[model samples]
Target: MTAPILEIRNLSKAFGPIQALNNVSLIIPRASLTIIAGPDGSGKSTLLKCLLGLVRADAGQIYLKGQLTDKNFEQIRSISAYMSERFSLYPDLTVEENLDFYACIQMVPKDRKDDLKHRLLERTGLESFRFRLAANLSGGLKQKLALATALLSSPEILFLDEPTPGIDPTSRLEFFRLLEELKKEGRTIILTTPYLDEAEKGDEIVFFHRGKIIKQGSLSDLKNQFPLLVFSFEPETNIFEAYTELSKLVGPENLILRGRQLKIFVPEGEELIWRGKLLRLKREEPRLEDIYFYFERRSEMMELGHDQ
Candidate 1:
């Protein structure tokens, strides 16, 4: 059996009184896209920073490439590139110049800089906009340029924090396509995003909430293991009013609003009760979002039980 490319064991971190990560452990395979997904302050970014040695964990061990080294961070940083939530590019620099600058920073040899720069430009589809100033580029193009810079070093592992937040859907799709290309080139990519739909594109997903991993698995594995039956329906009354009324009847955790449609998760044999209250009801397959919330609510209930 092949070993995991990266292994994190019993990782934990804290900030003053707040615990940022709690006994987190994960295994990442080579050449795969692993998404760390959760809401804001869920410790997704903290996990990435700890792995890259930007933030020190209070406890736990990180192993890379089947070995744990004394200079763990130094070795990891050498083979990794991180693009933070606020990836900065020189606004005044043209796209080509920006790439050139990062290439120099990554210490790409003088003899190979131009070839590497050109390849990245072509790969990111930024060759035509090479001469355009970074500040003038659209949000999506700006993100592409940031990715190009991160790739300048040809690092084996890429870490991205919320790389697609607020971008247009078209650009987000383009960015994901580039990631697929990188995976084909045998690069391990670990990223964090708040969007559950975006997390669907990952080879594996780790779901975090309030500094703990609630669940982790491949998309299909998660879907297959989901225990509840889901149904979508249109409420007969005003959507907001129906949601409020239904929350009292079925508990808020079981209900979700998707535009004008309502999605509810119920245990076995409880579908008929909800069906009577909603219109146009139909059984639906569970999505990533549904699975996430299911686990999240379970976690909350477990914690609540313990507290009581």
Candidate 2:
């Protein structure tokens, strides 16, 4: 892995009675797609905000290119682009006009601004709709425009917060295609996403829960680290009865019902207990969803055990 471009040491934050982030630490390698994956209020957004200086951390330090830094992130901001959760575009402005507005803000040289804008419009497939008003554009187009504006400065590190939700599937696929192209150009991309299925695209994933990081690693590495063996089979009897019976044996946390098929994860040697009752039983590879749930369940159980 390349040397770290962004590093956080013991970061923390709070909002009134809620602890938004707690002693969180992370390392983002240069030119890698690092995903922050978590549910709502899991501190994913807060961590991003802190890095961009939108929200101040109550404690901890942020380092840029291995250099310790103060709260003022102006230096970091100079080399970074951030596309927030909300589409921050001027509804009254045309697509071209919005690009012009952001170009001025990013201080792109007048000599190169027009050429860069033209290329960005073509790249994002917005050239034909350049004259269209922002309010009139579709959700997907608005997101594309937002991305175009963020690239106005040609930032080294791009931070995106849940950019895929609410968009159509085709648009979502296209957006990721664009992201893949960006990654090829050696630009570091950090994004927070709730969609674990699409997370395979990332070089590394940081899973967060309840204001803490549950686990962080590459998909294959995390799967290899998983302790359970996954299995699936079709039950000869009613699926509901099978589900209930299995739930009683191994708990619902270890079981997933897909139509007539039941999938489960159990410790070594435990599969023998239910093997005789199952029909067409097959061993299965652990999926990202299964791995995430395993870590999440373990974290919850540990917390419960600690509280007692």
TM-score for each predicted model, relative to the true structure: 0.91, 0.92
- Where does candidate 2 stray beyond 4 Å? 234-248, 251-253, 257-261, 274-280
Q: List lDDT for all candidates, in order.
A: 0.89, 0.88
Residue pairs clashing in model 2 are: none
State each model's C-alpha RMSD to the native. Answer: 2.5, 2.3
Give a tens-digit lDDT track for model 1, residues 144-225. 9999999989999999989887689999999999999999999999999999999999999999998999999999999988
Q: Which candidate comes out best when scored by TM-score?
A: 2
